[model samples]
Target chain A: MKIILKNICKSYNGRKVIDNLSYEFTPDKPVVIEGGSGIGKTTLLRIIMGLEKPDSGEVVFEGVSHEAVRFAPVFQNTRLIDKLDAPANVRLAAREISGDAVRAALIALIPKEELGKKVRDLSGGTQRRVEIVRAVLAPSDVIIMDEPLTGLDEGNARRAVAYIKENMEGRILITSSHSDLFEAFCETLLLK
Target chain B: MQTLSLSAALCRVTTSITWADSLKNGTARKILIIVFWLLLWQGASALVHNSILLAGPYESLLALCSLAVTSKFWLSILFTFLKITLGFVLGLITGILCACLSYRFKLFREFITPPISVIKSIPVASFVIIVIIWAGASSLATVISALVVFPMIYHNMLSGLEATGSSLIEMGRLFRFRFIDKARYIYFPQVLSHLHSAVLISSGMAFKSGIAAEVIGRPLQSIGNGLYLSKISLATADLFAWTFCAVILAYLFEKAVSLILKRLSAA
Candidate 1:
C-alpha cells in the first residue's frame, strides 16, 4: 500500500509545527521521522494516525482505503491504563487477536511475574516494553509509534526494536524518535 | 525454583502491607469508639432523670425490643427502606446518564449547569415541602431523595469523567476501541474512583433527606410516621429507638453500596 501526505500543515498558537510537510510511506519500507523536541514529529504522526487534523491538505492512501488501515500506536508516553495489569493492557487493544496469543506475546516481552502486575506499578522501562508489546500484539496494517523507545535503556531498546522488526513483517511501521538506532532499519524522514 | 520463591515473597509482602493498612484503622478500634460514645450517652440520659426529657439507654433498648416483635414496626421500616432505596438507585442511574450526555454535548452541559447549581444550593426542607406539594405525601421521600442525591452524583460524575487522563483517551482513539471496550477499560475505572467518595456522601444525604421528607409529608406506614407518633405521645424512648434504627439503616446501606462499587472496580 502507498500512503501519501500532501502539503500537510499544522500550527499551534501561531507557531507552525508542521509546515507543508509531505511524505510517502510504503508497506515494505519502514519510515523513521527524526526531529528535535517540539518540531512536530509527534504532531505529524498524529495527523497520519487521524488523531489530529492537519490545518490544510490531506493524507491519501492510494492502494488502500481508510477503513482498511488499522493503526496500533505506541504513544510518546506509555499510555497504558494504570488500573490494568500488563497483559490486560495488551489484550485491550488486541481485541481481534486470540487471548492466548496476546498473552503469549506479552509474556515473551515482559517477565512472567510482571504480566499480572498493574502497569502503573511497573518501572518506566518495563512499562515502555509493555506498550511495545501492546502495539506488536495488536492486529494492525500500520504500526504508528511516537518515540517508542523513550524510556528504555540501550540494551532493552535494541531488543524492543528487534521484536518490532521480527513481528511487524508486511506491516507499515512509522516511528518517530530522536535516537539514530532506527536509521539502520528505516528510511529517514527528517523534520526541521 | 527461583521464580517460586520470588512469587512467595511478593505474596508475603502484599499480605503484610494489607495487614498494616487495616491495623492503622481497624474495625475493633471503631467498635471501641462507638462503645465509648454510647456509654457517655447513657450517663447523660441517667443524669437527666426525667423520661420525657431524656430516655436512658436501657429504656431505649427495651422500646426497640418491643418494636422488634411488632409487625407494624417491621412494615414501616420495610416501606421506608424500599422507597428510599428506589429513589437512590433512580438518582444514581439518572445522574450518570445526564453526566454522560452533558460531557458529550457542550451546549447541553451549559444548559443544565445553572439549574443543577440551583438544586445544589436549595435547602433540603424546601425541597421536601415543594415535592410534598407537587407529588403528594407517599412519593415525597422518593422525590426528595432523588433530588438530594442527583446533583451530588452528577457533579462527581462530571469530575470523574473529566479526570480521565487525556493520554489514555488518545490511546483508545488511535486503537479504534469499540465503545464497550473504551467504557470498560478506560472510562469505568476513572469514573469509579471518584464515584467511591460520591456514593459515600450521597447515600447518607439521601437517607437524611428521605426521612425528613417522610416526616414532614407523613407518609402512611413509614418510619417517619412512627417517629411523629412517638413525638406526639411524648414517647422519648420510642423516638430514640426509631432514630437508632434510621441511623443503622443508613449506615448499612452506605456500606453495601460502597462494597459493591469497590468490588466492581476491582473486577
Candidate 2:
C-alpha cells in the first residue's frame, strides 16, 4: 500500500504549520517522523490519517480505499475508555482480537491484576502501555502512534517498541516521536 | 471545637454525617435535634389549641397508623404510584431520545427550543388545568408528571451529550467503532453521570407535580383524592397524614431510583 501527499498546506492563525509538504508512504518500509516541538509532526500525522484535511492539495492512496486500510491510533493521550477495564478496552476495537490475545500482549507490560481494572485506575505508564497493546492487537492495515512512548521509562519504552515491532509485522507504521528508542525500531524520516 | 485529623476530614468530605453513625459513636446529637423539633411542634400545636388549624406530630402519626390499616389507603397509594412512575419512565425515555435527536441535528434542536422553554417556564397548575380540560382527570397525573419531567431530563441529557469529549469521539472514529459501541463505551458512560444527577433532581419534581395535578383534577382512588377529601371535611389529622405519606413516598422512590442508578454506573 502507498499513500502520497501532494503539496499539503495547513495553517493555524495565519501561521503555516505544514507548508506544501509532500511525501510518499509505502507499507513495506515503516516511517518514523522526527521533528522538534511545534514543527507539525502531530498535525502531519493527522493529515496522513485523514483526520485533518489540508488547506490545499490532497492525499491519494494506491491499491486501497481509505476505508479499506484500517488505521489504529495510539493517541497522545491514552484514549482508552475510562469506564472499561483494560481487556474490554482492547476487545472494543474488533472481535477478531480475543481476550486471550489482549491479555497476552499486556501480560509482560501490565500486571495480570491491573488488566482487569479500569484504565483510569492504572498508572500513567500502564495506561500508555494499555493503549499500545490496544493499537497493536487490533486488526488493522496501518498503525499511527502519536508519542505512544511518552509516559514509559527507558526499559518499558524499549519493551513496548519491541512488542509493537513484533506484532505489527509488514504493516504501515507511522509514528511521530523524539525518542531514539522508537526510531531505532523503525526506519526514520526526519522532519525539520 | 478541635481541629479534625486528616482521616476525619477525608471521611467528612467523602460521606454524609448520618444519625446512625452518630448513634454508634454514642453522640445522640441527631436524635436530640429531632426531639427538639418535635417539642417545638408540640408547643406550637398547644398554643394554637385548634386541631383543625394545626395538627401536632403525634396526631399526624396516629392518623398515619389508622390510614395504614385501611385497604382503600393502600389502593390510593398504589393508584398514584403507578400513574406517576409510568409518566416518569415515559418522560425519561422520550427525553433521552429527544436529547439524542437534538444533539445530532441542529434544525430539530432549534424547532424544539420554544416548546421546551415554554414547558420550563409554565406553572404546574396551568398545565394541570389544561391537561384536565383536554384529557380529563383520569390521566392528569400521568400527563402532568411527564410534562414536569421532560424539560429537566432533556436539558440534563443534552448537557451530558455535549460534555462528551471530542477527543474520545475522534478516537472512536479512528477505531471504526460502530454507533452502538461509541454510545456504549464513550457517550453512555459520560452521560450516565449527568443522568444520575438528573434522576436525583427530577424524581422529586415528578412526584410533587403529579400529586399536585391529582389534587387539582381530583383523580378518583388517588392519594390526591384523599387529600382533597380531608381538606373539604376539615379532617386536619387526615390531611397531615396524607401529606406525610406523600413526603415519605417521594423520599423512598428517590432513594430506590438513585440506588439503582448508582449500582448500574458501578457495574
Clashing pairs in 2: none
lDDT of 1 by residue, B1-267 (tens): 999999999999998887777657986567778889889888998899888899988899999999999999999999899999989988898899899999899999999999999988999889888887787899887888888889889989989999998888888977778899899888988899888898888899989989888888898889999899899999999999999999999999999998898789778
In the range A89-168, model 1's lDDT, one tens digit per residue, is 87788877787887787766667888778888999989989899888888888899889888788888888888898898
TM-score for all predictions? 0.86, 0.91
State the lDDT of candidate 2 residue by residue for A51-163, as single tens digits. Answer: 88999989888789977878889987668888788888888886587778778878978888998788888899999998888888777888999998898899999888888
Model 2: CA > 4 A from native? A111-113, A182-185, B1-27
For each candidate, give the interface RMSD after superposing the true interface residues on Cα.
Answer: 1.4, 0.9
lDDT of 2 by residue, B175-225 (tens): 888899998888988899899888888899999989988889998889999
- CAPRI category for model 1: medium
Query: Residue A168 deviation, candidate 1, in Å?
Result: 3.0
Candidate 1 lDDT: 0.88
Query: How close to the true structure is residue B192 of candidate 2, measured as C-alpha lDDT?
Result: 94
DockQ of each: 0.54, 0.67
